[model samples]
Target: MLYKNSICFISFFFLFFFMLINFFFMMFFIMENMVLFLEWEIISFNSMNIVMSILLDWMSLVFMMFVFLISSSVIYYSKSYMLNELNLSRFIILVLLFVFSMILLIISPNMISIFLGWDGLGLVSYCLIIYYQNIKSYNAGMLTALSNRIGDVMILMLISWMMNYGSWNYIFYMEFMKNDYSMKFIGVLVILAAMTKSAQIPFSSWLPAAMAAPTPVSALVHSSTLVTAGIYLLIRFNNLLIDMLALKLLLLLSGLTMFMAGICANYEYDLKKIIALSTLSQLGLMMSILSMGFGDLAFFHLLTHAMFKALLFMCAGMIIHMMNDIQDIRLMGGLSINIPLTSLCLNFSNLSLCGIPFLSGFYSKDVILEMVSMSSLNIMMYYLYYISTGLTVFYTMRLFMYLMISDFNLLSVYNLYDEDYIMIKSMLLLLFMSLISGSFLSWMIFSYPYMIFLSLNMKLMVVYISLLGGMLGLLVSLMNVYSMNKFLMSYNLSFFLTFMWFMPNLSTYVLNYNFLIYGQNLVKFLDMGWGEIYKSQGLFNILKYYSIIYSLYQLNNFKIYLFSFILWMMILLLMLIL
Candidate 1:
């Protein structure tokens, strides 16, 4: 146990040291406006090259630095959270593997090598999700794995498609591929791949289901590394997808995802799942921005969102740990009175997530909203973005009211304490980052500033929506006197929002039920009917009959032998006459 704790400490130090070094490297690159690329061929065949490569620009460097930072913090927090568990070493190793995979993904310029990272992430995440060894964890792990496997399959197909160009390095060819009409199919496939990873629309179910994992895993995977992978991929390929009709479709779907996740999060009662849905909502926001050609803006939000969202999950972890793993928000209230520091962290992270002014989220989210307003979009698209933003504020406020402001709901016999300095210390690092990362990254990434020339109403659009959402959120929380009865009366509407419009059912049962039933029937028919008679049973019966007849003939049945000999002679004579 002491050795395991030492390993955690060493790992955290190593990651922190690397993060500092990368920070300096990022600053140097920014000063020189330089991009560093290095590659070595692993296989060469018929002018097609497969290589391991790295692309070090401001984007990859900064993103990798943040990944390491968050990973280090999560590891530190887990030392206390999982201290009593027997598999401490195993947990640390899985997390380290996850971080390594994410770094490989961040650096890779070649699609083939990217596959190594992408599939590594999927596999490692599954291991982490099912670490608890329970039915819920196992099911969630399967869903997470299978859903991501779709993206992996698409990526494999993409590698085959890119082989047409005789190179697997997408970075080198993105500009050329931009105008090539024949490569539009590749762009579509790429969008589908991103959709599955980022949890956009139909792929959104897995993200919330994955809340069954430990909270630290949720903080690392869902908040920063795993879910952001899709957005990162799209950001890298944004130039190629800029003009494709697929991006327009992506835009619509992403917008809908934002709205849908926001609505679902408001109705969710599970603390971790609520935060998981919030992560999903933010992913949609990033995807929507990327689809509109604001790759840098999307990337900006991705980084900032990572900081606050990870912190949010960590805070949620602390709460769930204190509450003895009780996750239902309905069973939790007035936690601020007991764990003030945690409540502070939770509220700050939530506010940042809601785009509160001067925080990390506001720096990126506000700009993204302004950019959305300035873009040439349809009215529905415009409304969805703003409405989704407002809903974000609403759900966050609702969560805040439920967890921090309401009356204490737990039994008096239970003791609550917040003396876990290790967890608190880990959270403080991200709490600091969540406060400043947005402005810091925004200044670093954007060379030429975005110009937003909009009318007065449009200029304050985000503010207006935020205010309205805040008001409604407060009203909803405090006005629950008769609302529960009314909600019970309107069961269908309540059920729809609460279950994310049956998205879990859609993905789990509706999607697989028919195919599963058909497969079962096919198996039965093959085993009991055609396959049985034609292959095993029929062949065995024929062999047995021949053996029995031969035995009878060998048993000195002279009449049978004579009859057989006469039949053969008659057959031979007829053949000769013909």
Candidate 2:
């Protein structure tokens, strides 16, 4: 029975792998030179006259390579991690399905095809997220699926609108959008779709909630695969978004998301949630940079973030596996001796996460900072770049210290290295790749910005300051200055603690608290002011009162008969037109 099972598994695995490989290459051959025709040959669609197939030669290749590498590693990692487990074959099938969908998403000929591929992956991910079949996993998966679907619904509507206007049929839609004034609306809707997939701002809560998934799922979902879909959409539609005011709104949203997530990561106790929120924060920063019109920088960051973040999560998984699935930092410590290799990889990844000089993260992240300075887009971006860079280092180092150095020994009750060598090998491979991939890709993308330019040079002063700021954060982490013990001891007097109790009041007085936190006061002021302006006397209030009075007056049946007749006539006219 065992031999038969082994043979069957191997046969099925090879079959699925080769089948997908063949399908993708086949699609590539057919569409190799197929220009992404928007509309049949209708009206004439011309955006830049630059061929998308050729433009995709480099960027699409980079993303496809990432998809394959990560997916392959995930399968390999799961092999050892799930050994002796039931439903193994089903898991492998899902793995192939995921790879197939993701690759299709990358190579898709147009927005519609890309979306089809994207939605397919979203479906696969929902199943994967709830794979454990526990209630919490189900709940988290449901929330994640619903959130992603909301984005999808917006995207579908936008696509339908674009198709109607012939944008999908660009030469197809030119005649249509030319008269519609709806491109702007569709563009904004598309960005909203991307934002949710990318986990920006208000839609971001689901991402961290998704940590309930198995560690591998968390690693795959957060580290530049699922979330990166949003960035990909924006990049693909760069020309359209360039002139939209929605781009600026997206930029501001990204900045706020990056800042808030970094702060929350600093407060999280679960090891997975720390990395989860960090992924959310980093994606936001990348989106902000891209929104500022630097797709190259965004792509570069996407690359490096994938490498280091994956390495970190896989290492976290190893740690959790050893501790019998304990994920809380409060229950971990002193694993440096027990899991030396894991510790080393974790430290290096953390350095990259902190954007230490010369690490992969440094090259990609600092380049965005440079762009912020160099671009004539917005002066306000400078503050966002500076402060978020600092927070990135702070929270990253804090998690590192808490997990590897701080004197928590609750994990002593459990073993801390039960993982198989296969898992460790996969992680080490990622770390090794991450150590060099960023710099090498940096050179490639930078030299070819029009084709592949990935800028390496940032403002020297800003780079220096950001590096120094990260170091300061590292120092604070090393000193254990912000340990939970300290916070608990002074819980009442703690600013964060007090603010937690009076959230409503703090929100109300945020304007008065200006200048305390870098952007908190400003955000508070805006929210409060906007709240009072809208809630107290905004147009909606007037409309609400009007609605009540109108309903009561309608009860009198004065104009009821005439209104009903007119409404019926209008409905009949609309129906006839349809």
Candidate 3:
């Protein structure tokens, strides 16, 4: 059963069944508006016990449904995408491992338990990304693993801090210590961990570089599982994080992350990398909205974005297959004529991603934009929010033009086979969901309608900017390569955009890039220079060498030396006796 037949079919049906179960449970809990908490003590000793706790609520149930939905789709799609690969079983196993970790992370409110799931996600993600066994993939995996370890360390520190404060269960403690001044430090540590895990500005390089992984893995990871873990944590901990001073800093950094990713996607040519950047941009939106004290909105966007993003990546994988694994968007076009079904899925998913009207992404993206416009946030935030929204449209339109509307630029003969149907089946599942998941989820999530009051012009601004970004994208894509390069385009700006604000150069494996360099200089100065001179071993070595040289003089007159030594020994004894 494990190897003779299709493992994808088995896992797909299993996860799909549970996803429906979760959806039912989520609806029941929402209707009742109740949460169930269970704790079992395995080893009890004093105040601390080996008891792990589990929380079941509508929120967790909804998240689990989305996770299962996307994961099953990805696994089934991988069946066709990886048909020739020898280790298909291993790939399926890793995806299941990640889902388990994500479920662990979601239901546990204890810091100690969260770390286990958190670390598991990091470990499994690293393994999946480097599944290719190449230099680039290995380096990307290292970056992903090393960057996430910072968040893991933060969680460990939080565990120690919480243990000393009386309980490992954060839910109980957080509810009790809502307004304590001492909770600020905990908030700081928690935000740091979330930022690292979510790939906010400084930690974002790994997300794009992670495109080295197979496209199916990208569909699972970048959509709802790995990157969303941090957003989930923040949502779980919003009680502690709200009204803190660090939240303002988070707002600014998250806005910058959104703006940066949006701009970089337009400049990027790699199809997977463009999608990766879009994920980063959406992550920034979630974090920013969460920082604004709307966990519900963030969670809303998270689920909706997951549906469309997964479908988008799956369609990209299908196209990349048509291009013989060529991810360069410049060499792709007119796919609608060939694979009409895949192209339709890709186009709808892209529109959903662009927040086009009535699509799944629109329900979330529109709410977020309206919320941003209505909030009394600072001017800089307004600029970042609006401009980034426009840039997202720009990059998405540019990618669509390069892939669908432009001429068919593939040099090789394009062919479609029967195995391609496996991918289409899974794609259709997600494709149907992506179209309607947002409205259904938002209706289920909010008890009452959101009240958004704005002038006609303010409402039109979002539409106007989106149209402008789209037109600009079309114009730029239509320009001849030499003409576009020869015009006002500055090579320096292009290079900066290419490298994503030089973040890779700035993010070190150990932690901060600055700290990495600072440590080397510290070692060079203290441990190797002045420290060596005063070290006991150094002084002893120098004295030994000099003593050996002095022994040569003693050899000149051995008897005289012996007599002198004997006299000195006698004199020392006399002085001691006296």
Candidate 4:
């Protein structure tokens, strides 16, 4: 009862207070040196020393404010969402642990501390994903864990690599050895680790799969905790690690990731999976921009995206709850009438996500697209960026129609109502942030705004792509089984896109097939060779059976003598002939 009522409020209030303090610090740092540091020595040895460090800067402070703000709101939201569960306390504790680990990751400059936080985020995320204890959640959790475990290994290797520099504080030496072979080696390790955490390309399957988690966790995971961890790491190490070679590769991979995730979201039917894929798409955009050495732009987009994405997930969760946990978009329509406030919030967040002008997303994404246009990059990347941007609108509008514009499609009673005040209150907080964060961040992050020069055609390219995408979305959403069922007509293409380019299939079944077969063979061989023969009970039973056979033969000596005489005569004849 206390947990259901008070724990969230306690955490929420405290985190809100801390957010204010951090925001002030962020402003101060921006006006001053833009970065500061603190260190606390934990231990020292003859040649080795351990120190814990905190990185306090405008960037870190801003990230901390967002993390604290989003997590607090998420915790508050979860209290109402998970009210009926028996293990509510456990869920709340895990959420707090997740936040603590994220804070560790956000502030730490020391490699050891960062590793602790990095590994902690992965471990806690696995626990949260399987919080429901179902087979689906279990499978999702395993996929999430093993995929992230690769990043943990890479971080460990990086920690050892840094040992040659004689300090566990990676922040200290990133600039000093930026061009050395060992440093580039470190960059490779960092990029690999960040890729797994951020769900780029091959690791992307886990991001969507992780939707098996509770929706509040989704709000946190997608917003600031799990997926953004990688982007944040890359932002911190951008100048230190990523070179031209790494940049080109990252740009290519992240651009594909953006395109792939956007297409999947458009084809997706599950409400939460669509949102999850949307987060993946946005992450890719951030990574792509960062790869071009625009770390500030990436971070700007990251903060703004976190605001709206959290609200988006919350609104989706509210609707899903009203629908009795049904997440299929096909089952939902005309919700805007029944749940006006919730629907309004949902669409606004969705619009922000589509980068509608003046919204938080618009300020960041417009700059990113313009930056891409002006930069000296190849035609493929330019095409990919715009095409993916349009796809974002396509999915967003498709989802909008399915959620709000279509006729009512519910089979059960329509319980969709904007009555959950507790949930609404937290969502309103994020809605306010998503509305203003981008504009505020744009003015604050830079002393002078970015002046991008482009021809008129290129300047309007985003508007053009968005309009085309909106038309595609409208067409896709309006098509019915009686008119045009794309799923059935082009089932193969739909299946391929919806399956996230068969990443899950390749990652799970195809990749593990030989290993699973070998394991099965090993089990069979062990049981047949050693286990079958060496068992005490089996050995005793065999001896007893043979002794019984011998006793029976002795009792039947006359019959045995007749058989033996015939055998002996044949043998003697053969010997004589020889």
Please report, in order, the local distance difference test score of every candidate based on alpha carbons: 0.90, 0.72, 0.88, 0.90
- True-structure RMSD, every candidate: 5.5, 14.8, 6.7, 6.6
Stretches of candidate 1 off by over 4 Å are: 41-50, 481-489, 519-578
Number of clashing pairs, model 4?
0
Better of 1 and 3 by TM-score: 1
Q: Return the candidate ranking by TM-score, descending.
A: 4, 1, 3, 2
Q: Which residues of candidate 2, in runs, are more than 4 Å off? A: 1-56, 165-180, 377-379, 411-414, 448-578
Per-residue lDDT tens digits of candidate 3, residues 1-578? 34713688899999999999999899899999999998878897888669888999999999999999999989888887888888889989999999999999999977878899999999999999999999999989989998899999988888877765787778887877877765777888889999998999899998998898899999999999999999999999998888898998999999999999998898788899999999999999999999999999999999999989999999989888877888899888887777789988988998998889999999998888889889999899989988998898898888878887888887756674434878999999998898889889888999988899999988877898899888888877888754785586788877787788988877754356567689888878778877777886689899999999888767878887888899999999999999
The C-alpha TM-scores of every prediction are 0.89, 0.73, 0.87, 0.91
Residue 508, candidate 3: alpha-carbon lDDT? 59
Considering TM-score, which of the candidate structures 1 and 4 is the better prediction for this target?
4
Give the better candidate number (1 or 3) by lDDT. Answer: 1
For model 2, residues 95-168, the per-residue Cα lDDT tens digits are 67766777766665566766777798789888888888999889778777877887889878877876554435
Candidate 4 Cα misplacement greater than 4 A, ranges: 45-48, 481-490, 528-533, 536-578
lDDT of 4 by residue, 497-526 (tens): 779999988767787789889988877777
What clash count goes with each model?
0, 16, 0, 0
Q: Which candidate number would show the highest TM-score if scored against the true structure?
A: 4
